[model samples]
Target: MSATAKKGAAKKDGANQPFIYRHYDQEKLRDALRKMYLIRQFEEGAEESYMRGLIHGTMHLSIGQEASAVGICLGLTDEDQITSTHRGHGHCIAKGADVSRMFAEFFGKITGYCRGRGGSMHIADVSTGNLGANGIVGGGLPIAVGAALTAKKMKTGNVVVCFFGDGANNEGAFHEALNMAAIWKLPVIFVCENNGYGMSTSVARATAVPNIADRASAYAMPGVIVDGNVVSDVAEAMHEATERARNGEGPTLIECKTYRYRGHSKSDRNRYRTKEEIEEWMTERDPIEAFESQLMEFGVIDQKGIEDIRESVRKEIEAGIEFAKESPMPEVANLEKYVYTEQA
Candidate 1:
């Protein structure tokens, strides 16, 4: 059924139904679940490749925070842009990136995004509206505001989603960007994926506000908090924010209270968090599993359908790795090709 039709049917059935069921059709919901799985499997593949030395440099994994990534982008179109963080593989996938090209980028092959120069921390797909992932903390905030300003000036009616971690809340750019976005009435959504820690330091140690969303009040915008583990909840919050932005009501700050199963980066020793805490989140609040159960309960998908998605994702990841392995590498002589702009 069409989304509008489904929404009408849902309203006729019951108002208490989750926003996702009321807004999105079954096909879209299933696709959302599939994308969540893809994000999880893609990260796992990248992690394995990194361990085997196929990928160079370090990568931050968003293993347990799949729901936040997928849910936020659920209502977005290709025209709606997003700036991602270093742990941005999930964001790229959520924004409709090709896994093969992503794997190629990780392998530093010439066929990769940014011609293999960007790697994991800098993957950008303009066609999919992903501006690029930044390695620096709080780096994407101002960039997102810039994008939103362009949209507002051009009357494009497109919104920009800026994905940052809990640590970025303490950055000067975060406050500046939020204030600027608010004053300009820009179509930007500041999504704080608070995974509890900024490197070894927890949010409690780094941030003063009780929740990152609370800071939005200072900017004179609405602040929302959602269960990042629950895809429906995240989607609901994102949908509301998107509507508000598209209506020219200015920006919104959404804090997704989630956790990362892995360390901050590949080199992290994970001494700050305990094993039981990580295990509890992984076992009890695994985003993909929670989403899967939701899909099943809502009759959106069944066991066999879920298995099919898993199998499809597995094959895709295998093919993506092979594609990267078979792809060509950039020559040493052309190292400056994308580095410097030639004077016209």
Candidate 2:
């Protein structure tokens, strides 16, 4: 069948997908696809490095949550800020963090985002409005609130997006931060990338509420539930939340129901979840696959276009890995440089 006929048939059969975006331009959609593919490839590289014993510290992989990361960040501008969690490579990359430096950070080279001190969990680049990814669960919440407060006080017209796991939502910091933001009308977006587990503990076993967004009602703000696997759905939700924040309404709590294809961390084995469940998510409901299908149905790109994007992303990641490998390690004499700030 011809490409036009195929597209027409898909639409007739309702294959165009329900989350059709009206605001996002064609270039933006293509860029979103590229960014998501880049995050996937970068995580794959990190896994390869981890298996080879090249990386020292442990790393958390968000292999299945790229849609949530890219979707939300697509709505944010360069001036907007974000806070990230341990599994924050996607978040950092979405916020325009340099991949080469990120790989260097993983390699513990001096050229990394944290100058080789923070490793994977603690990567931070304030220049791109990514404050940092915190090692502690729920740690980024208060930091995000603080950034929002700063933006509010200075009238910078910038919004802060905080990316935390489902596990972090139960912490006291989560509640306190949301309450404060609501009361002060802080321009912040609290995004819950609920990947179904908190380091082996299922959300059903830990969280009391059925949905994490339900907690947002306590703060007297809007609570949005997004299909974490759908990039367009996430982007639209973030756009609405950002608009509310920019209008000085208050903070928003968004729960994205996503899943992690791999284990929680490097040491984790397939103990809690089943193999069938993993296969289902990875094969059938994979975010990248779903997004590609939708893009194709929308006539945004053909199969050749998809392949080209993937090839380009693969080369970019390979270059980043080479950059990290050739970078110099931190000098012992400069170990304490970033530890303590000198009095100005």
Candidate 3:
């Protein structure tokens, strides 16, 4: 059965209605779903190999965080910029990174994007305008703010998308970054993927603010909260924000309320949550499945088309695995390569 079939019937909610500014076409929505599937399958494959000891390092998988990544990326331009998170493979892929090379990075092969230097947390594709994914919490936000400032100065009109988790929202850097972006009217959209929990602790325990978006007012910008599991809603929100930014408006804070199915990292047994909780979210709130249902309702893709996409993703993943396996490991003497800028 397809992953969509595994989820129970979705409940009707106000969040299900299409947004006024939703910028999704048949091709765009289909590509969004395809990107989400690519991230999901890649992370699942990475988890399996890591568990089998084939993957050597620690990995922060984005198993349940697909919509925030792909949905937001859907609104990005080819020349636009983005900063990613510790769980960054999804961001990389959504920003147009090569799947084979992404896998090769995890395999520690020389051909990996970082030449096998940075693992799952730090994969990047500069040509795609993905600045880089950061392993440190709140690290990317300020960097994105800087990028936005540069864009504003250059009068480029290109927006910068900053992807950070709910945990990073509490960081001092988060507030500072937003404040700076707001004051300067920088073309930056701060996306908070609030997946219920930060590491093992639920958002309730870690955050006093009821809504992360609500805090945007303090920064003197618009704050919007949307169902993160619904790709159309997120795409709408991001679209609106980017347009406003390009028009010389300020930044917007978007809180994407969603869930993560797997443990914080592969290391945790997920003792913080119950099986029932996981099952509930999985059955009702999976973004990929939710988007698939909407696509079918709109006749964007039928069963056969969905299956074809699944098969295509699977074959592509398998090909990536084979390529990574055949790729050579980086030379020992090149340990310090790509780490520092070369002297003139």
Question: What are the runs in model 3 whose C-alpha is more than 4 Å off?
Answer: 1-22
Comparison by TM-score, 1 against 3, better one: 1
The local distance difference test score of each candidate is: 0.92, 0.89, 0.85
Model 1 is weakest, by summed lDDT over 10 consecutive residues, at 1-10
Say which candidate scores most in TM-score. 1
The best candidate by lDDT is 1
lDDT of 2 by residue, 165-250 (tens): 99998999999999999999999999999999999899999999988999999899988988788887788788889999999999
lDDT, model 2:
0.89
**Residues 1-344, model 3: lDDT tens digits:** 12223122332343443642134567877888899999999998888878777679788888878988887888787689999999889889999998999889999988888889887888888889898889889999999999999999999988999999999989999999999999999999999998888898888898888888888999999998877777766777888999988888989998888888888887888888999999998997888987888788767789998898899999999899889889999999988876789888
- Model 1 TM-score is 0.95
Candidate 2 error regions (>4 Å): 1-20
Model 3 pairs whose backbones collide = none
Q: Write the per-residue lDDT of candidate 1 for residues 147-243, one digit (tens) a residue.
A: 9999999999999999999999999999999999999999999999999999999999888978999999999999998878778788888998999
